[model samples]
Target: MRPDFAASSNPDSITDSSTWEAELNLGFTQRGDKTVLVRREHRGPLTVQRPFYPEGEVCHVYLLHPPGGVVAGDHLTIVATVENDAQALITTPAAGKFYRSGGGEAQQTVNLKVAENASLEWLPQETIVYEGAQLNSSMNIDLAEHGRFIGWEILALGRPAAGEGFDSGAATLNWRISRIGRLVYMERLRLDAEAFQARWGLFGHSACGTLFVYPASSLHLAAVQELIGDEANRGVTLIEGLLICRGLDSRADLLKGFFERVWGLVRGDIVGKEVCAPRIWAT
Candidate 1:
């Protein structure tokens, strides 16, 4: 089988020697009832906007990737830490794009830590992977006892509305979650051309997503199930104290909307605060 996707980025891909390597690190600590960005370091094209306090002390931030899209040989790393009693919510202003690879793979990694009694929300927009793209992405999260988290990741295989499908290319996604110094959950997914079309795999869905909320309840699971009642291609479950939700669809926008609805339903239970969408989402 052959992949039916683009051969390179909108322009040509950069050679491995000339590829961009970017890294961003941020630290947040509680200061007088507010979480302040106490430490920041960025190299290359990655940076963040000033923090916003739309819902009181919760620090809301939007990560920015100035280069807009990634191609072969690009690597990005992000690390964020929230100190005890601090609270932070992070997101991206726009969807990330992984263009078709000329050769080597593009990679992105995220590391997050929440200290005891702290809260962190990782809610980036979905990622768009063009045909022939080779991407390796992973997220690692560590939470101390009593720390709370609500986050989601969405992947769009191709531009379905534009008549494109993931007929070629490769993607590997991984997630690691640890609480109280013990690993609680881990997942790995490898999707390729065959898996994209297989009935036992994506079954031709162009978009898929997962949402996780730590320290959840049966009632919360019930609430999410109640909201998703009878909806095909959507499911929810409670594992230990984590609530996990999954969705699949043909359009990325639709899947993202569905995840947003679920986020609204379960946020209060997970974070003790009602769903206050980051204002950046509006534009």
Candidate 2:
């Protein structure tokens, strides 16, 4: 039987709490030729679905938030560990929503560890920051020798299609990537409504996205160049062993699709497995 979300079956059970603190820890290991999710634990609204082996050897999991969104005073933390030679892919079923905060800030932190010869793909959907929402998000990845990671983060500020704009509130992002206990990539970003207006900042774009990959070899870099195609809003760069891609667009969905195309191409070349959209992504 497939494992499902562990949070309260009733989504409303978490909304009444003055402050929400949730944590999920997952561990994956390889058994013979197939990777499996061997450990899963949760403390609050955070949970994960059963592992799916669409690629035969790669384990796929969907992270879940029963409350459907993060409000003020909500803190969520996720920690995932992949054992040696194990391969895992993690994603979300839907876009994460950061609701308007009356006065407090919502926080989320993700920590991923990949053992030697292991691979991890972090491909959560876009994050929507509603008007007046204050949010802080951080992600840290630690890799051992020969470990690999590919992931992306997309943020949409305000609901432009609905006539709402990010007139107020603040959002901060921190990301750190390391291998063998040494830092390879790190970034810090602070975006407020006022900063969003500057041409040098988000470039007046309501939505921005970034994709990062580790162990980017010459062949992988060439593959990325071929994938660039006619994407004028996107740029790719290689730093150390990491390949960084960034894009800005008024439509978050369109931007995500563009990135997805690139992901398919590069992922196939580097991981030796063609990109297969998660079943949940289509639903």
Candidate 3:
């Protein structure tokens, strides 16, 4: 007999849920010799993709490995810091998928900090939420003066390929981006299965992603619009050098592909890279 799969009122209370945390600190200083320092600490069983830039340069690190793949009551935390003049790019090996839990809820928290004139990219792999799963996630970022950061989060509510179309599950996401202790942008999205499937909400789509580009400039604005022109299903906004791009899709891969394109454009124009495909991303 198959087990019952239904939404529970208290998903966070399940006893079997797992927990995990990972922290990485990157520092760069010009002390007669230009060198980069990396300190990584892992407290639990999490696999990391390792940070890799072109030509094997360590721009940033990508950490993976979920404590326990999003079972009911699971909690996960990821903390990262980049010191002054440090440049890093972080990305997951693949999409982070959350399976349905029998009982409680699953939650994840991410915190990122970039010092003055430092550049950081928090481009994790996309996240897919299965039916009957309840998830709440938040991402908070702090940047200093002249700090540059690029971040992206993609969420897929259900497996549309298997005939699942967000008919189940609940997700709440909160994100805030700030620089020099000043708020730049803040937004939240709370979606239930029904609301997510509404023609107007996700417009019956199963996947969506948000890309944030900070400390916006006029050139960046024009470049972003040129890159995202007339994508009917996506939305774009500019706020204080922060470009926000949101896209809705029924296929998970579509979201990933879209993000890759956006990343390439932004990196080339803003980050001074002709090709931003990190070596680890291709691996």
Which candidate number maximizes TM-score?
1
lDDT by residue (1-283, candidate 1, tens digit) is 1121233333334334456889999999999978999888999888999999999899999999877778788899999999999999999998898887877899999999999989999999989988888999999999999999999999999877677788889889999999988999999999888998998788999998899999899998888899899989999998999989999898878888998888898777666789898888889
As for TM-score, the candidate ahead, 1 or 3, is 1
Error of 3 at 76 (Å): 1.0
Q: List the residue pairs that clash in candidate 1.
A: 3-168
**Of models 1 and 2, which has the larger TM-score?**
1
Candidate 3 all-Cα RMSD: 5.1
Off by over 4 Å in 2: 1-17
For candidate 2, which ten residues in a row score worst on lDDT?
1-10
Q: Write model 2 residue lDDT over 113-220, tens digit each, in one string.
A: 999989999999999988788899999999997998889999999888888888898899999999999999899998898777788777668889999988887676
lDDT of 2 at 126: 94
Rank the candidate models, highest TM-score first: 1, 2, 3
TM-scores of all predicted structures: 0.94, 0.91, 0.84
Tens digits of per-residue lDDT, candidate 3, 1-283, equal: 1121123333224334343344433344322322254556655545455444453333655666643256656567777787776677777766675667665677788888888877777877778787777888989999898888888988988777667666667888999888899988888888787778677688688888888887666676677677778877867778777888788887767887887777777775555555456555566
lDDT of 1 at 275: 85
lDDT of each: 0.88, 0.85, 0.70
Once superposed on the true structure, which residue ranges of model 1 sit more than 4 Å away at CA? 1-17
